[model samples]
Target: MSETIAFIGLGNMGTPIAKNLIASGYTVKLYNRSPEKVKGLVALGGHSASTIGEAVKSADIVITMLSDDHAVNAVSEEILPALKRGSIHLSMSTIKADTSKQLAEKHEARGAVYLASPVMGRPPAAEARQLFILLSGDAAAKEKVKPVLSAISQRTFDFGDAPYTSHTVKLMMNFMIFTIVELLSEVMLMAEKSGIDKNILLDTMLNTIYGAPVVKIYGPLIIKEEDNPNGFGTQLANKDLRLAQETASEVGAQLPLAEVVRTHFEAIIAAGGGKKDLPMLVSYLREQSEEVVK
Candidate 1:
């Protein structure tokens, strides 16, 4: 018989990951705070769960992909009492390392297993089942979930029994991504001020030594003044940056560039771009250009 899995938090990324699991022939019990979000999955023969507790009650595995530490904490508390003994809880959200470690211990005390398996990639990657997962937990627990993880991700990087390791790596990765966006915004602003066409500069950069897939993917949006239909919204990006900054502060690490990126995001949010796509930071950069000209 196939394993029964409970997938909670059916947001943009979670929805696709769950769809991939269902396509891969798993019995998935899907639950989302907004029940409407799970209607498509329900129509596809997946089970709709009314609550988190109801979702994992009979499942062999539980997976969560929520927004922040508070959301994860709330779901964990609500579901821990209902989870069957020995069932594994795979947390796929990018959260604070300390929070992940604490939750892992709490779940272990409840006779349940927990694994920090935050993934790297956006919605498109999730839809394609091409996410790269970073996992940290007991080897045996990791082994048990390997097949399910493989179904949704192209590769999984194991970081041993330190649950916080995976979360830390995820935050560091986001720091790099956000910093790149900041640099891209600054460079585009400079080019525009120099009478260079933004598209021309982008095309040249894409074909040169500075080119990579990230720029190739995000460059056009930055240049075209398009802001809607986000792959990842600015609010979430700002949240992740704040989490990274908090983690860095806890470890006495100096993340000067990340600090600047955080400030840029704060400016974006203050300017009412919070609901827009993250790449919309270019709009803020353009505003800065106008201010400089005046």
Candidate 2:
């Protein structure tokens, strides 16, 4: 589409997504809070911008993959002023729906297009360009960036034209994943304490009706007590869960299980498992059980 992209936020997921865009022959201007990450991308033929305004000024498409709502808000200060009219501001962060709606309104008022394009996949999937993207925003702007999205995602699913819809979908998807992880931890621990083989049970469930990506991908990690080396830490998971809980409450929907899962993640973070992977929820359950027994 002959677009220049300003890629912001060079964390695990952003790093590879930006790499994929560079690989796709897009002229990318890279910006990060950390210079080391920008240097790494520069080595791969990306242009480094000294400031967010510099990155957003000459870009046709500005993409933000920040960590949270606050990070996105801070970046917007630099981007909104320097962003060219008619440019597309694509947000790929897992942020709150209200945050996205606010951004969309501000972008529209500024004559820019804002899109919510939250993704579903871990860092490995992003690195491999196999992440599933959920998109919602101005239809014309979406079409303009379709090729760019294709370059970095396995598939892009449209959720109509409401910018917040994509964020809602992403949060719900995350809630389901976290709930499953919580349930799996409980079941796997119970099986272990009852003298049942976790590996055999997980294998059986994985090959049966419960053979979904969530179980198959995370089951082994929990069983082997492996940490999440790529995806996300418990703290981030808890944040997403809290977003989901807030979203559900806003819509007047009940999510009792999400509330329970949120507490589990909160406890995990309080116990200093915040930086550990999501699979460590299983380990946390095991430790708590051991403490009770003691």
Candidate 3:
């Protein structure tokens, strides 16, 4: 608990993660562009900083949990100039693998280290410290951040020395989640139209086939259509999907189904569901299936 930590980007997930760090007896400096967010954490034994540089400058480790690539990149610029030698930038954002590689190179040039340690979980899971953390980068840097990782996650999967490997896995994980969302959406539509009882479909899914935790979680959400409060919003879901294809393009890989799922996301957004939770894709797909029958 001797190490000082700076947590930037106080979104849903970031807030709880930062609070857990403070609760774990680490000194936490909190920062957000909107001072209001900083205030909330400040009430919970966190120190507030008005700027990213001010938050991270003296800290032993700087953690970023921003929304996407642009936000992560903008903060990395400020972090590079202020981070001291041997310090760590624990980037927990769901960003591009290329961005992680680029950030690691820049940090190394400045005598600092970047660890692409993004996590998989919702805000509630973050609050419970049950996230599955993914880490990949320099051996020493990864070693240094072990305490911080332990404080925030139930398990850490080391993706090896290449920093980009972690992000690749993170994106692939999210892509798989979205594919489940897409599949659950379409299958639920068919089930409803075919008069398959909702409980029966869920029971069969959980018992017979496709019963991973991700499937177990979303199956009922799609059946009940419970996307309220936005566990995974459209903007971020679409951003991850887009990042998947962009990453695929970088290596000449194909993601045909991902491409189609993104189109459905676009159509949902265009129809004024931009702010809706991702499971709303079921409703979107249902409307389309109805049209085909007509």
Candidate 4:
């Protein structure tokens, strides 16, 4: 018999990941705060549980893809008491390293296993099962969950015994992603101000040394001034940046660029772009330049 899995948090990324698991032949139980969100999963032959506790009660593995530390903490606390001993809880959210470590200890104390397996990819990547997962946990626990991880991600990078390691690495990765967005925004604005067409500038850049998938994928969205149709919303990006800054502060490390990026995102939120795609920062950049011209 196959191991039954429970997936909590049926958001943009989680939904597709669960769907892929079902397709890959896992018996999946799903729970979402918004009950309506699980309806589609039920239609597709997955079971739906009314609560987190009910969802994980009989499962061998539980995966969470919550929004932030608060949600992760709350759900873990709520479900920890109900999870069977020795069952694994895999966290796939971008949270602070300290929180991940604390959760690991807390869950382990309850005779349950915890693994930090934060993923790197957007919704599209999740839908395609092309995500890169960073995992850190007990070797045995990691091995047991490998099949489920394999179903949702193209590759999993194991960081070994320390569960919080994956969370720290995820924060650093997001810091780089945010920095790229900020730099792209500023440079695009500079080019536009200098009478250069945004698209042409992006094309030239893509043909040069600095070009990569990040630029190739986000450049057009930035240049077109299309802020709607969110892939990854600004609020989530801001939350991750704040977590990264907090992590740096705790370690006595200076993250000057991260601070700047956080401020830029905060300003974008203040300007009502909180619900927009993060690439919308380029719109903020263009507006600032236009104001300078006035």
Candidate 5:
């Protein structure tokens, strides 16, 4: 609560996380490319920064919740130069493990610590402070920041000293989710073809052994075709699948489900459904069938 926290990226997940910080009595500096996006947070006691340097230059801790590897790295360049020694940059982006490792080296060389703190949970869960954080990097830094991380997350799983391990685990976690989404899509279509409502099938699953949070959450989204662009987009979901496959190859691991999921995602993107909400993958699967059963 005492730390001056600079929060970069004000997208869906970032918004709620920053709000939580302000709610918890931290001095929060908010930065985003679209300065207008920070206004709502500003109204909530967050100070808006017109530039990345302005946000991070004096902060004791910086947190990045950017879109992808490129966006995270782009800001890292500006952040690295302006951030003071001993400051912590807690990156909560889902990115490649190698990218996290590279950032760790750069941060360490500058006498700063980089904590790979990829988080799980949708915007709603974040708003509720139910997000799970997969953390790795400096152990001392992890202890120093647990309160800050815990302020917005239900639990933080520390993966030890290697910063990139958390990102690797994040990719794995997303792969499992994508695989579940693929199964949900198929089961939904199968039920639809057999004169069963997708909603009913999902209802039964939720009451039985299949009711994990991903199942409970994505099930309804797929059934209702909730394609809100502000939620997790289809294209970014595909990018994570691709990252999972790439990370698999680096370890000489075989992921048969990844290939199948990637094929479906590519088809969805090809048909211009890339920006749709992830559960709308049902639309892609339905297009491949005899008829889109309602």
Candidate 6:
């Protein structure tokens, strides 16, 4: 018999990941704080649970894709006790490294395995099963969930046995992502201000050194000022940046660039762009500059 899986936190990223498991021939038990999302997943042939405890009671694998540390901690309170012995709790959320360490210890104490496997992709990537998973935990537990991880992501990068390792790497990646977006915003804003077409500038940059996925995929969106239509909100980006700052402080690392990016995002959220996309920081820049792009 196949292992039964419980999926909690059915947000934009979690919903599609759970759907992929169902499509890949796994039994999925879903739990979401909002009944509507749970119903939607059930409509796709998933089993629903009224609470987190009910969701993980009989599952071999439990995956959480919560928003932040608070949500993950709240759900873990109910899930830790309910999970069976030798089961695996896969956390796919971007959280603090310290929280990951704390959760890993708790799972170990309960005879449950904890894997920090946060992903690096948006909702579209999740839907396409093209997410790049950053995973760290017990080697045996990582192998045990290979099938489920493969079903939901394009590739999984291992980061040794320390569960908090993945969270640290994830924060580093977020710091780079937001920093790039901030850098692009400054240059693109300058391009528009200098009487150059923003699209043309982006095209030139894409054909040159900035030809990576970050530029090719997000550059156009930033240029178009696409809001958080894909579910990656500014507040969420701000939260991740804060996580990076905290991690840096813990390790005595200086992140001057991250600090600048955080300031821009903070201003963006303050001006009511919290629900907007991270790429839309250009709009916030334009507001502060009070200059026409064209």
Q: What global local distance difference test value does model 4 have?
A: 0.89
List the lowest-lDDT window of 10 residues for candidate 6.
Answer: 285-294
Clashing pairs in 1: none
Model 2 quality (TM-score): 0.97
* RMSD to true structure for each model, in Å: 1.6, 1.2, 1.3, 1.5, 1.7, 1.8
lDDT of 1 by residue, 52-165 (tens): 889999999999999999999999999899999999999999899889889988988989998999998878889998999999988888999989998999999998898779
Question: Across residues 1-294, which tens digit of lDDT does each residue of candidate 4 receive?
Answer: 299999999998899999999888889999999999899988888999988999999989999999999999999988898899999999999999888889989988989999999998878889999999999999999999888899999999989899899999999998888898888889988888789998888899999866887888778878876765538788889998888889989999978998788887888888777888878888777777778889
Stretches of model 1 off by over 4 angstroms after superposition = 197-200, 228-230
Candidate 3 backbone clash number: 0
Which stretch of 10 consecutive residues in model 2 shows the poorest summed lDDT?
A: 224-233
What TM-score does structure 4 among the candidates reach?
A: 0.95
In order, the Cα lDDT scores of the candidates are: 0.87, 0.90, 0.88, 0.89, 0.91, 0.90
lDDT tens digits, residue span 1-294, model 5: 679999999899999999999999999999999888899999999998989999999899999999899999999999999989999999999999889989999999988999999999999999999999999999899999989988999999989999889999999999999999999999998888789977777888889869898998899888888888778787899899888899999999989999998898888888888888889888788887855344
Instruction: Tell me each candidate's TM-score.
Output: 0.94, 0.97, 0.96, 0.95, 0.96, 0.96
lDDT per residue as tens, model 6, 146-193: 999999899999999998799899989988888888888888988888
List candidate 3 segments past 4 Å from native: none
Error of 2 at 246 (Å): 0.9
Q: Specify the poorest-scoring 10-residue window by lDDT in model 5.
A: 285-294
| Better-scoring candidate (lDDT), 3 or 5 | 5
Off by over 4 Å in 2: none
Ranking by lDDT: 5, 2, 6, 4, 3, 1
Of 3 and 4, which scores higher on TM-score? 3
